[model samples]
Target: MGEVTTSLQRPVTNTGRSKLVRHVDSFEIQPPAPPSHNGVPRSAWARARRRVSRWHRPYITLLLLLDFAAAAVASLIAIETFDQSRAGFYNAEQDPTWFHTVAFGLLPLGWLVSLWANRAYDRRYLGLGPDEYKRVIRAGVAVAATVSFLAFATKTDLSRYTVGTALLAALLLILLNRMLCRFVLHVVRRNISQAGHRMVLIGTLPECLEVYTAVTRNPAAGLMPVAIHVTDGYAAAKGIETPVPVYAGRDVLALVREVGGDTIAVCGSASSEPGELRRLAWQLEGSGVDLVVAPQLTDIAGPRVHIRPIEGLPLLHVEEPTLSGPALLAKNLMDRVAAGFGLLLLAPVFLFIAIAIRISDPGPVFFRQPRVGHEGRTFRVWKFRTMYVNAEDRLASLVDRNETDGMLFKMKEDPRVFPVGRFLRASSLDELPQLINVLKGEMSLVGPRPLPADDGDFLGDVRRRLLVRPGMTGLWQVSGRSDLSWDEAVRLDLYYVDNWSLAYDLSILWRTVGVVLARKGAY
Candidate 1:
């Protein structure tokens, strides 16, 4: 019998950034989450539990299906090709029959089972970024090793060739499957979430605004806000934006009690200390309302924070970011290998683009601008110039026509763009020269987008973005390059920096192809 009109979930794509779908979890008038506190005492684990536990099981199930299919294909191909090739050798490998085929099929089956035993089927993993993939990979390696050991322990001569091929195929298939899952889940979740869960938001006026903004922004999570509780001191200033009605003072709880809200969000930066916080939690429990707290802990991801019970107190620990040391080594190797191969593969495309740029405009084909990069170092970012040669000089004249948040300048029809450049930018063909930046170690295949010198002042608030190399197509580019507001751009960049992983980078690149093809919010 609870009431809420707005929908839930975040915008699935950049094109929907300004669509004003209800925020999935804004603070202003948001239902109480399961203990979402920020900073000193972060109950992020609980908040994440609600999120990851829902998705992980489905994600893992998909991975299991992928493993079975990939292994079937690999086993068949390996047995046919490798066995025949070995037949001519003096020490020929044993050929497989139906018995061997059955055994071969069991290899991936065992691997999938191992993955499940390793908690791969946990629900807290679906639609998440990339740690989920890493876990799959880690589990896959262990499972493969176990199979190899079993082969050696037993007298059965399981071909190394078969195992290797199966592993490779499984990895590629899982990667592709994960990307497809992300797209499909996004579509389905956005459509079906409106019918689920009802909750009410009760928080201080200022804090309520923050919560409201978040919930208002992402509506696919299906949160319908029934009412908002405004604090006594600030209730007069509650003239703000939100879809729900605001009730002043402690009576708001009675209002939520009346509506039977499932959630009560307490957003008080200074008023609610540890003891008061627990008291509020107790009240929420008695009222049958799930309690959620919104503190100002921006940019900290769930993985970085660990909670442990010491005696009766819950202690939270935050690990340092992995931008250096082993992570950097892995990233460096990946960058060089991927960049080298990309440069070789795209050589003809580069040549064709150079020719096209030369033919289109008389200006220099390559655009080099001073951009802030890793560790706040300034480097020249390369691009296929998509503007007139004097476009920089012409910025002042077009300053008044900015379509997005004032921090960015855009014209639906920009005259400074050379005719071909419009298509080039829309298709992201203009950013090809960044491969050169990657070669020079000033950029990566996937990282934060480099900012110009004029945008330097904002770095004080968002310095984490410089922890890694800049990229040609980053979260910013794939999410909707020019469509994001200044704040949204920084949020995406920080999120990427805080949560860097090989699988996440691959997802971005995979999504990049779709973003480019769909041509959404690119112009």
Candidate 2:
């Protein structure tokens, strides 16, 4: 018989209970207690830290207030725009009445309610990626559709222009407000101590390390790893060093409690059995802790993953990647229209670049290189001449000075690059000529970067990158450009391939503008 202890009037045992606790030989560690400060032993400090770390409520409330204010402002702007346009219209004689008051009041309320219905305020979707923005857009569309249906069915005297303008304004304002909020939150998180939820990672050493790297890299996501609970025998078999303490334990609930972690991230290798996970969830009930299970799937996006619980068993379904759907068709159409417009708008800039290149060195205005394109076909990828005419002849001599890894050759300050070429590369102006490639249907406004045709033999399975037309700027360009390792570049490209969406493309394009302005990771 093993000695047991009681916690909160419930017996804690190593076995024979709803929660299976198979204890190992690892020593138990207690959670951090309050320290004495100026003759005061403040035990409540730990609790207060935990409370502050859970910022979901306050964050959501702030967003709600911002949304309401945006709605009111947008409504006023829409009404003013409509009134100015319809100065002599028949409805101008109809004085402001209860209808106006009711409309103003109900529109914001409907917008708020729709956002809630779409789970826009959910903590899981907040502070990360484009999910929150997608939800907000969906909510706005839902409200617009509902309002249109009501007006059409009830024959209400409503201005379609006013309604449409107000909704669009509200959407843009809300997104802007949310972005500002995230920026402020990120600043606070970086400056403040104990700003994020304390998380205990449970998995094998490698798996735990992987999750730890991801969480630390995106500190804005608000998951701070306090400790790691490795699977039995992993620590002894393969020793590893981490910023946080590591323990070998089979009882996840006990480890979480000991570490005082409000979140438990179980990596793919930790809980292989579904029943074990279900039991752990049951034991964690009323514990005020969250359980996040990281699946084995890599490079897959949220939209492709679906979970269906049937007969008490959860089944994960992944949709295959396809580029022939209506979504891809819409993407293609947008690419052509935007690329054509960009070329027309920037024709003067193009001529200026051409003249600069001509004056800087006697060479063609545009440089063409054979690049692997969609379906492994080859195309002439065009760019403004950013190098000397004999750049290729000097390539072999500079191979030893290559700055980037694997098949790509990158040099921060190569002898073959002209003075004007450095400016072009630094500001990414040289790639502007690829807009023509996009317009000609050999590429897209957003996709994987086209690799040199000679490197095709090294791609292996990564040839999947050729499924869609290469892009002028892609995950590689926006993320780190010449600074990224070959593996990292491939990973990002595959991630984009696995999870391409119009919203994601728009997000990347927006980020690209900022990256270019900041001049980060560019040669």
Candidate 3:
């Protein structure tokens, strides 16, 4: 729900919940008529949504710490705060018959064992969306339940204090860790997008148009699609309403030479003769543009697609994503750690920002906007108020000042910003409150920035950005900020998703410092 519109303008949220968004359905873009023997058929965009990492590590770590801390505190209170004999005992000591002193001291070990035994690390639903969080919560509950059932079944002496304390500690820890990871990733992505890498989307008329829309939607991807060109069914350079110009140059070789695209997406099948295709290859032989051809393989995945050179013709193999064993373990480990830390560090930041906002504005410092989070569920996103208390009442009058490229609004000098609000925005202090969002698990520190709930008129076929949590800072934040046009922003975001890596996060964070200090895109 937070974003940068353009230069000379700073557009903040000032609309009421009554304003609804224009949502688009995924109307599968179809290909040209039955493929003539003369040209290749249509292509499918099998792009995978980006999986945030690096930041996830802290989320995991924080969770572990919280769980341990909670257990320790609970044990102390149980052993001293309350009489141990009063609560039903479910003793876990084995043949060793450890003494009370050690048994009370052994809370940490018991808590660890319980955490592992319940498979809190096992994530049956990781990226399928909301189910992932649900699965983890269920697992936590199951672990606690198992311990309780075991204690009762055995009729052994057990400390109810120990079990409750351990469970509460683990839950709090995991949430804290997740929060930390979100911030790390956010900081990291900003750094990555600052690296100088632009993108050029190549495809058929329709496909290239879609690509243009993608590049305009997310700028944190670091790959700015400076220009979009169609490879077929068009003869001249055309504009596609993207932030960048759209050129429909049919000659691949000529386009490659003139436009000099860095990363080329062969969006759909082209009508070039084999000889033209060869010439295009020769022209691009040493040029660094990554020529990615998305063939007519719908429902295909990267794992299923392998490259093998048969003589000179490149072929691809496809495979299905398996859901089991190591994949599950790796995913679980990733989830727990990410969710854990995110909760801890953000806890304090959230407090400070909330207080700051309250000091400046009489209205609630935290403005909660219901946004579509993972899996289309609505979640309230947290942000600091930077506008007049009655800003929403004045939106209709300001609509004319809206410089909209697509679904976004750009107002160089908005009337709604209060005096202190400008500094908060320039320093990005306004976004500090979103750390609460990271804690809610509704957003990430780094990812595509979210869109306003009801502002989806011109976005057209570019709705995929909603597939993931909106980021606090992303490819666009470091690329050019408000200086970037809509096309450039989306290109960078799409590119980030296509070529995401842990290193990219590190890179984005470094660049973010430069952007902030220079105030390149800040208001």
Candidate number with greatest TM-score: 2
lDDT of 2 at 28: 35
Q: What's the ranking of the predictions by lDDT, best on top?
A: 2, 1, 3
C-alpha lDDT values of all predictions? 0.66, 0.78, 0.54
TM-score of each: 0.67, 0.82, 0.43
- Which pairs clash in model 2? none
Cα lDDT tens digits, model 1, 1-523, are 2222222333234355433433323222333333432234333443422311134445556767876776666666665666643312223434435444453567668767776776555544545445557767877788778867776787554556655766666666766776676667667657765332356565565666677676545554445566766554433443455566665433344456566565666665633565766756644443435566665555566677787989866666877767778767887788888888888998898888888878988878889888888888998988888888889899999888888773457786899998788988888887877888898899998988887866645436478788788887788877777878877888888888887777678878987898889887776
**Best candidate per lDDT, number?**
2
| Cα TM-score of candidate 1 | 0.67
Worst 10 residues of 3 by lDDT: 1-10
lDDT tens per residue, model 3, 297-371: 543334446888899877676544332356434433443466467557667866776677677778877667766
* Model 2 lDDT tens row, 1-523: 1111112212344465533333333333333222312323335443223322468778999999999889878887887787733421226446655545544677888889999999999877887777888899999999889888887897766767777888899899989988998888877777773447798888776787788887786566778888777775433424455678776533566567776788888887777865667767766655567888987777788888899989977888999986788999999999999999999999999999999999999979999999989998899998999899999998999999999885778888888889998899889999999999999999998999998997645457578888888998788888888888888888888888888889889988998998999888877
Ranking by TM-score: 2, 1, 3
Over 4 Å off, model 3:
1-272, 275-306, 316-352, 456-460, 491-510
Q: What is the lDDT of residue 207 in candidate 2?
A: 83
